[model samples]
Target: MFIPAIMAGGAGTRLWPLSRKEFPKQFLNLTSDQSMLQQTLARLEGTGHSNPILLASEKHRFLVAEQLRLSNVATSQIVLEPFGRNTAPAIAIATFMAASESPDNILLVLSADHNVADVAGFQKAILKAQALAENDYLVTFGIVPDTPETGYGYIKCGDPIDDNGQRVSAFVEKPDLATAQRYLDDGKHLWNSGMFMFKANVFLEELKKYQPDVFDYCQSAFNNMQSDHDFHRIPEDIFEKCPDISVDYAVMEQTASAAVVSLDVGWSDIGSWDALSKVLQKDENGNNLRGDAIALNTKNTLIFSENRLISTIGVQDLVIVETKDAVLVSHKDHVQDVKEVVSTLRKNDRNEADSHRQVYRPWGHYDSIDNGKRYQVKRIFVEPGAKLSVQMHHHRSEHWVVVSGTANVYCNGEKKLLTENQSVYIPIGAIHSLENPGKIPLEVIEVQSGSYLGEDDIERFEDRYGRVD
Candidate 1:
């Protein structure tokens, strides 16, 4: 049986403004209506695969589960990492979990944030890798490089092991432009796709030989794991003490059993804004415009407006993206440097580096509409039958006015039902919880007045979704 282990922990910083720390690009629908993570799961449909095992960060556990549920992909196990410890520990934990299914079960490792246009080709490649994996080779699918892409790392291919496999020579880091061109000209280099297939025991053996310390730490973590529903929580104290390193740096690059299988499926990692623009459809004038937008004389440009209209008269080879709180406008060639812009925002302690106006939670989401020194306004949307944690704030009082559906409100030990246009007030230090009692989503405008209005002021006493202290 093939157990797909989807890795969904990277915070894609290059696609900022639209992608944030709390919500990353993997959860964003970069192509079509489905998100990249959802697309990753959909790619495995009817491939004779079972429920997948997900390895994601604690911060994104709910989002991962929600997305998978929406995609109709029931996960077998959801392993939660206390912190981002890179792929070595992440894969180790996943490997240990896969072992419970069977000692010789094959794990098909895939990143949650990539797009592959040809799902059939991907499945075909997986079949080939599975055949090799059954023979104990640690096989990774390498994309046949279509261009001299300096952004992606390359894999040097050695002599053919069989008619369909080649021994991996070395994993090369991102090269300079000239070297990338040289790599393309050499005819022996392939882009490191990072997708792999390995027997559970084979991967564990390689880990033990190449990275014994990481193997030992993850072994201990797996032994101490606790399960809640479909979620598997790794022991935070010991897992946090594990080394922070990528899998390539820890074992894949050092193991002699590594093998590469060539894949020509249409693929993109979407590492930058420029990369995303390429995957989208363009107009007759070579422009990809999203949201409320009008353009004239634009050529090969990408413009996105989240909350307002964007008009461009003569923009060419540019990217103009706008959100409720931040806007990004840059030339296509310069989009890769957007990470430096994020660094600048971090240095200045800007909120744009972390989130947008809308904040997602386990139950629902809230979008800040207006704010001031002593008062703030937000539009909250609670999903049907969902409830917020029973909590109180130290310095803030809130007035909630229901806009749609029905709300079950708990305030100061009193429970009340509120319908459309009705309102309720929870005074400072009063425990409150809001629930969606109707079959549809409950929307409300929350107005807050307080000396301090930060989110950290909340004291949660009862929460269905287990959160950090």
Candidate 2:
């Protein structure tokens, strides 16, 4: 039996503005109607694998659950990391969890934010890798390189192992243009795709052999794991001690059982805007435009606009991305440096680096429409049958005007049913909650007048989602 394990913890800061720390690229539908995470799950439809094991950070637990529900993908487990310790510990925890279910089960490890165009070809590679994995050989899929791309690390292929698989000659780091060209000329090198397959017990044994500290820490974390609803929470303090490293460094690079399977499928990590542009359809002027964008005299450029119309003229080899909260304009050649922008935002303690103007909650979402000194206006949406926590704010008083559907408002033990055009006032220090008791979504325009409007001002007496701050 084979089980899919998706590593979905990346912040994807390089695609900033569109991708943030709160909502990363993996949850965004950059390539299709389905999100990258959904696509990753959908591609395994015909692979006859068991339900997937999703590993995500605690902050993204709701996203993982909601996306999987939208995709109609059934997962065996949703493991939540208290904090990210990189791929090595993440995969180690997955391996331990899977092995507890079945030691013989093969684990097909995949990244959440990758685009694979040819599903058949990808499945074919998985079949070949499964064969090698069944024989206890650790397998990684190597993308057939079509260009001298310096952004990706290269893997040198050795003698043929079995089926189309080859023993890994060596794992090479990202090289200079000249060296990358030589590697392309060699014809034996492939792009390290970072996808892997191995039996659960085999991976655990190899991890224990090569990186015992990581394996031990991960095992302990898993052993002490707690389950809250569908989410599996690992012990935070123990997991934090696991070495911060990738699986490539701790195991694949040192394991003699490592093998590489060549994959010719159209694949991309979408690590940068330039990489994303290659996969999207281009216009007559060789421009990739998405979401209310128009370009004139633009060539080899990517323009993405959300919540606004973006028009560009006489631009070449550029990337312009606009979000509700931030805009990024960069030369295509320097798109890789977009992470530096995120770093600068972090250094300045900017909220745009972490969240969008619209913030998603477990119940639904809220959009900040306008804000000024001591006051803020927000449009909040509540899913049917969902309710906010029983809470109160110390410094802010709020007035909620229902715009659509029905709202059951509870303010300091007074329960009132409100409909369209109706309003309710929540005084400061009044324990209050809002619920959508109707069938359709509940939309409300909330106006807050306060001394402090920070989110940290909320004191939750009770929360259904078990959120505590």
Each prediction's TM-score versus the true structure = 0.98, 0.98
What is the Cα root-mean-square deviation between model 2 and the actual structure? Answer: 1.0
Q: Where does candidate 1 have its weakest 10-residue lDDT segment?
A: 460-469
Minimum summed lDDT over a 10-residue window in model 2 is located at 460-469
Q: Give candidate 1 misplaced runs (Cα > 4 Å).
A: none
Clashing pairs in 2: none
Superposed Cα deviation of residue 3, candidate 2 (Å)? 0.7
Candidate 2's TM-score reads 0.98
Residue 213 lDDT (model 2): 97
Best by TM-score, which number? Answer: 2
